[model samples]
Target: MSTSRFLPALRVMLALQTVALLLQAITAGLLLSTPGGRGLHNASAGVVLVTALLYLVVAILVWRPGGGSPRAVAPAVAMVVLVLAQAMLGALHMKALHVPLGVLMFGGSLVQLVQVLLARRAVAA
Candidate 1:
């Protein structure tokens, strides 16, 4: 199993996740700070959900044999779980929880992205 085989793809996905995080962050701010862009804000939140799912798929890809770190599964699962809760928070109009949770999600994704980018791939044994 070559750990480096899928590294590039994993990195790309993580980067995309970061971009999605940025978009989500901006939308969240707009949602809270202004009243004129609810549509775009909602759309961005949906995009964040979709991107999180995409990130999970890539995370699983990296965690599989012949690829990235097994520990990546943690963040992958966390993203799914967190996103689900985030959706629920939004639906319930729990802005207090929803906003903070979104921040947490963004931070988690950022941390995972950094870890992926900085990792030294294991040499195939």
Candidate 2:
């Protein structure tokens, strides 16, 4: 497939990742106040991980075919790593690190999503 085809896929994956991260944050709040919160948070963690991996895969596809910037790969990799670390921190009950890292992940994912959207507009223009 042409590299351009991967752009749409990449954008979709980034959007998914961003949404998943946001849901994770919401569930984290629920986790603090409700008995069902922990289960929802835990499930959302899996969604975040899956979306990150999908983003990484699309990033590689975009880069490997010489259609996209290699820079995209780095952030995708970082997202995967950050999500894994976040999962571990939560599992270990390290709220101090987990909370801050979750915020960072959500912020970063949002930024990445915006970048991808802007890039698409730039391409279309």
lDDT of 1 by residue, 32-123 (tens): 78886677777877777777787777667767754656776677778878988988888899988988888888888888777765564443
TM-score result, candidate 2: 0.93
Model 1 TM-score is 0.82
Q: Which ten residues in a row have the lowest lDDT in candidate 1?
A: 116-125
- Superposed model 1: Cα runs more than 4 Å off: 33-36, 65-67, 120-125
Q: List, residue by residue over 1-125, the lDDT tens digit for candidate 2.
A: 23466888888999899999999999989998999999999999999999999999999988887576788899999999999999999999999999999999989988988988887777667
Pairs in clash, predicted candidate 1: none
TM-score of every model?
Answer: 0.82, 0.93
Quantify all predictions' global Cα lDDT against the true fold.
0.75, 0.89
* Clash count in backbone of candidate 2: 0
lDDT, residue 13, candidate 2 = 94
**In angstroms, how far off is 117's CA in candidate 1?**
1.2
Off by over 4 Å in 2: 1-3
